[model samples]
Target: MPKIIVEVMPKADLLDPQGKAVAGALGRLGHSAITDVRIGKRFELTVEGEVTEQILADVATLADEIFSNQVIEDVTSIRVEEAQA
Candidate 1:
């Protein structure tokens, strides 16, 4: 089996209220070093059987189409690797 990791995040140009609120809270809590905190989604998928290139490609497509919204979020990265036994 193999695991696929997909990361999706808001585009830089967009305003992230969640991130801003977190950053403000961190500053108030004396964690000023943490200036920016942009939140994102990470999806880990474990394939049932042997993983092939086609499977990886399909995963990427799913990441683009199903997992993320192109309007605000960007598919930052997608990775596929063997899963731990």
Candidate 2:
């Protein structure tokens, strides 16, 4: 099986409230060096077939359509690799 990894993150121009809160908390906990933090999501999907260009294109479509929200979030990267045994 081939595994598809999708990473989604907020757009740079957008304000990330959760990330800001975490950064503030980290600073209060003495991790002041943590200047910025952006929270994101990762998705792992197994496709029961060979990894091909068509499959990758389809995965990209799925990432843009289903896994991520184009308004607030952007799909940063999508990788397809063989699953570990």
Candidate 3:
């Protein structure tokens, strides 16, 4: 099987409260060197058959329309991972 992976992340111009909280926690935990953190989402679509260009296109649409909020997030990446035999 092959898997289609979609990555969504908060827009650069927007503030991520969750990310800021995590960053603050990290600093408090003595991870001061870690200056920033941004939370994102990863969606996996496992394909049972051959991967096709149309499928990829459809997945791209789904990533933008269904998986992420366009106002605050962007689809950062799309990738295919082949299963290990």
Candidate 4:
């Protein structure tokens, strides 16, 4: 089996309130060197057979249209890998 990995992240111009809250907590916890933080999402799709270009393309479409929100997030990466037995 094979798998597709997808990564999504918030638009650079948009503010992430959750990430900001985490960053503030880190600062309060004595982590001054940590300047900022941002949050993202990862999705893995396990395929039943050999990975192919068409499958990859289909997954790319899913990543852009379903996995991530185009308005608030961007599809940062899409990759194929062997599924662990």
Query: TM-score of each candidate?
Result: 0.91, 0.93, 0.97, 0.93
Q: Highest lDDT: which candidate?
A: 3
Error of 2 at 8 (Å): 0.5
What is the C-alpha lDDT profile of model 3 across 1-85, one tens digit per residue? 9999999999989999999999999999999999999999998889989889999999999998999999999999999998878
Off by over 4 Å in 1: none
lDDT of 1 by residue, 3-79 (tens): 88899999989998999999999999999889898999999998888878898889889988999998999999988
The clash tally of candidate 4 reads: 0
Give the residue spans of candidate 2 off by over 4 A.
none
Clashing pairs in 2: none
Instruction: Give the range of the ten consecutive residues with the poorest summed lDDT in model 3.
Output: 42-51
Of the two candidates 2 and 3, the one with more favorable lDDT, higher being better, is 3
- When summed lDDT is taken over every stretch of 10 residues in candidate 2, the lowest stretch is 76-85
> For model 3, what is the alpha-carbon lDDT of residue 66?
98
TM-score of 1: 0.91
Across 59-82, the per-residue lDDT of candidate 2 in tens digits comes to 899999999999999999998868
Best by the TM-score measure: 3
User: Which digits, one per residue and each the tens of the lDDT, describe model 4 over residues 35-75?
Assistant: 99999999988998898889899999998899999999999
Candidate 3's error at 61, in angstroms? 0.6
